[model samples]
Target: MIAGHGPLRRLKDGTAELHQEAELHVRILDADATLTDYRRYLAAMFGYHAPLEDALAGHEGLRRAGFDPARRRKSPLLVADLRALGEDPGALPPCVAVPPVTTLPRALGVAYVLEGATLGGRYILAKLPPQLAPLRGRATAFLAGYGAQTGACWRAFAAVVERVLVTPEAEAEAVAGARETFARLIDWLAAQTRAAGAALREAS
Candidate 1:
């Protein structure tokens, strides 16, 4: 347990279970996962991130808290990877069931899940199947987010989270938002009727 009454600690500890569950539900690293599965993963991710980031953009709290959301965007990376794989990202449907980041606390919580993925991107990149070797640089951009700067980026985000979510109410909102992001993302990826439908469902 991260022993602290601080909102960041609470948010991290509170979402630990859901975090693990989300990992289990995410299939990009599965041993048998193939190139098609990778394409679907990006598509599903694009579906989720496209809408979520749109919600976070221009939020005053992010600027006040010293967080730069533009630098943290993953949707573009997903699009580039998809295009490299010979898919038209614009043709894919974006997820509409995205969590609402209506407030600073909620936005922070939602961003927590999205920003955290950069850290795991290294692991995901390393575990990518040999089949992806042909599309190496192009297909792996999303997973190679921030590359060597991932650690610094996470620390900066942590600072913003801890600085902004100082009150109990803010903590509650942030935690709830984080948990919802985790749950909804899993649902968005797992639901068989969305952009990634068949491949993501198979991945799950």
Candidate 2:
């Protein structure tokens, strides 16, 4: 239903349900969320993104597909935000493992999820409470990564994805990869939420 090139259209349609489920689990729209909640959210994000970015680093297929790993990496930004929030990055729990993205199409699929989140990040940043407003671009670097250029960056990545996923088989692979990424991310965030709740109970 999403109007776009073949691969992107397939990705949007195939992963729509999974994407909605993941967003619900992440609870980005919870207006009553506090600074502590935001910290936990960043931690969850770091855990999800670190491993995936590591796998995509220096990937030959991504480079050949015209995707730039440097411009797209957000794991470091998550770590920085955690540190800025006075949480030690090394003290956070390990990130969940992502499925292997061995081919260009698969990488593009994963990239689609990661890059698409940044679009929504702008809205998330805007919704932060006044007490947490100062952390916008610093402690929330991952969300505000591109600052004003976020839309342009997404458009550029879309162009590359459309170019790389040319064949029918490639488009299918991209959709499969995006669906798998969304599923794993939902599981990981749910686990993190449970862990945080348990910790809160113990402290009280």
Candidate 3:
């Protein structure tokens, strides 16, 4: 896991490019000032780089497969495209088409552990540890709300992923897990949007 400013640099190469793209949404969450400061506090307490290099290298591999790093630079939403399994950013594996909100947070929370492993190797060893569950829970809540908000504005999210991350490849297990999490959140938001639309129709 290479850490630094900007999108997954590892996608520049072929091997990890797709996986790199799929995880782009997490980048947006990381960029939030509040979240960044919070993560920094934890990372610092344990000694962490603002940006890790290994993860970036992994992202570069994905870029080589078809992800456009330049697009990711435009905005965080563009980073979402990197998560698609194929050219169609909207397409998703059956396993991830419907994600439960309850399970979403735990999955989203796993990102820190995954990122740490990718970046530090034995340097970091494991996750934030069970002791940090409070922080992790907070992150999960933030992610849930953020996803709902983002999904309500999904065209933007889709645009970002389609432009930069969509590629012709199998949605690997890791990619599948991320997609499942994202799909669940987006689907839930889409439902809420539709319900709101229905209420507006009744008033009209």
Best by lDDT: 1
Structural similarity to truth (TM-score) of each candidate: 0.88, 0.91, 0.24
In lDDT terms, how accurate is model 2? 0.81
Q: Name every residue pair that clashes in candidate 1.
A: none
lDDT of 1 by residue, 1-204 (tens): 122657767888989999888787667677677787788788888989998888887677787789878767889899999998899999988889999878988999999889877877777787776666566677888889888888888888888888888888999999999999999988977773354565567899
lDDT of 2 by residue, 66-156 (tens): 7787668888888888888888988777665676778888888888899888887887788776767777767888878777888788878
Q: 1 or 3: which has the higher TM-score?
A: 1
Ranking by TM-score: 2, 1, 3
Write down the TM-score for model 1: 0.88
Residue 63 of model 1 has an lDDT of 74
Task: Please state the error at residue 75 of candidate 3 in Å.
Answer: 26
Tens digits of per-residue lDDT, candidate 3, 34-125, equal 43333322322121111211222235433453433233221122123222211222331222233222222222221222332233222221
How far residue 132's Cα lies from its native spot in candidate 3, in Å, is: 31
RMSD of candidate 1 to the truth, in angstroms, is 3.5
177: Cα error in model 1, Å: 0.5
**Ten contiguous residues minimizing lDDT sum, candidate 3:** 45-54
Highest TM-score, which number?
2
